[model samples]
Target: MSEPPKERVKYIDTNLNLPYHYYAGDYKALYLRALKDKKILGSRCSKSGKVFVPPVIASPETLAPCDELVELPHRGIVTTFCVVNVPVYGREIEIPYVVASVALDGADVSLYSLIQECAAADVHMGIRVEAVWKPDGERQGDHTDIRYFRPTGEPDAPFESFIHRL
Candidate 1:
């Protein structure tokens, strides 16, 4: 006898409210707290001599634990970037802004941030930029404390200066 036909699967759409809380551990807690004061904190791996911004507990490249935390400057080079022309949900900024990988001075790894205060066309790899921080009272001890990075008008960084971070 022939077997009965199998049931066909149907798809349904639904929305669920998922509430969550994030807890930044010791290292991230220190990093986020520093943001409230407009400071960038980085951790250095003694073994590899590499520094990481948004400080991680261990070096990603060397798998070595980092105990030395240092403050980093806001200035950096735009190692790479992309101009956003598309819109997405929950986007707080307008389109046509440049999002870039910034290699802050003294940090071995590059940090990502929005590039502003200049035309998108003016943003290019190796451009020198500085963080534009929000007022101290307005800081929330988070990434939002940094409004954006703007051109410093300094000469572009030497390729050798930031090429490794890229």
Candidate 2:
């Protein structure tokens, strides 16, 4: 009698090393340039007076044209977040790091970034945070210029203020 054939493998789990570049258009190019100058810029919609970080050409919500690029404060509020247990391919950070969506003080929109300088357990929605920039000489005209966001001692935002918009 023939032995039962081995069950076929149903899945394979592995990581792929895919290198790629994000096509940055005019608006994004301007924003990325400002990073080299240690400035944070947001696009403002003339119609709604809403500003978006990592400036876009139009407002995602209202679909209004954003013609103005305004400098934004480095401080922002944590709108939401998740603790990441999986390690990044080349980054050396330990497992269980916090990735958060930060709502800059003046911008209506939020940008996602890493959270550091404190335990992951303490990260939460509405927590105030300030960007920790790489030293001037180390900046390379990219989001990497801002190493991470660290908690600010200031009070957390009132949920009502941001909750209404989200």
Candidate 3:
């Protein structure tokens, strides 16, 4: 006699929900206020003559309390950069984007961020870059407040212009 027909295999899709607690602080509030005024803020080390963006609460080198706040210029130079092709967190960002290390004018250390409004192939070490601020209504305390830096129309800066910062 013929065997009974075999049963078909089936799969199940499960959706789960988890619960947790979260906390939010006021740091962004202060930062937002500063950006709204179109100022680039940094924490100054009075004894060492060092400054840090986002105003660190303490000096990284000396571990000393940072009490002085300095407003830095919006313009800076690209010390180095890399091209980004993959989307982060499955989120899409303009591909072939240049992520650069920029040393703001008059600051000792460089900060890393995207260099927008230009071809990635054209971005290079020592390119002069200028800050592109977001519209007044879009102002936020985060790095996006400055939007991005683009090649300055000015002539390429001489090595002397940014070597000291490096």
Q: TM-score for each prediction? A: 0.89, 0.83, 0.75
lDDT of each: 0.91, 0.89, 0.78
Write model 1 residue lDDT over 13-38, tens digit each, in one string. 68899999978799999998999988
The global Cα lDDT (0 to 1) of model 1 is 0.91
| Candidate 3 Cα misplacement greater than 4 A, ranges | 1-29, 158-166
Off by over 4 Å in 2: 1-23, 164-166
Off by over 4 Å in 1: 1-9, 12-20
Tens-digit per-residue lDDT, 78-127, candidate 3: 88789988877864677868889899887878877888888899998788
What is the TM-score of candidate 2? Answer: 0.83
Best by TM-score: 1
Q: Is candidate 1 or candidate 2 better by TM-score?
A: 1
Candidate 3 global TM-score:
0.75
Each prediction's RMSD to truth:
3.0, 4.6, 5.0
Clashing residue pairs for model 1: none
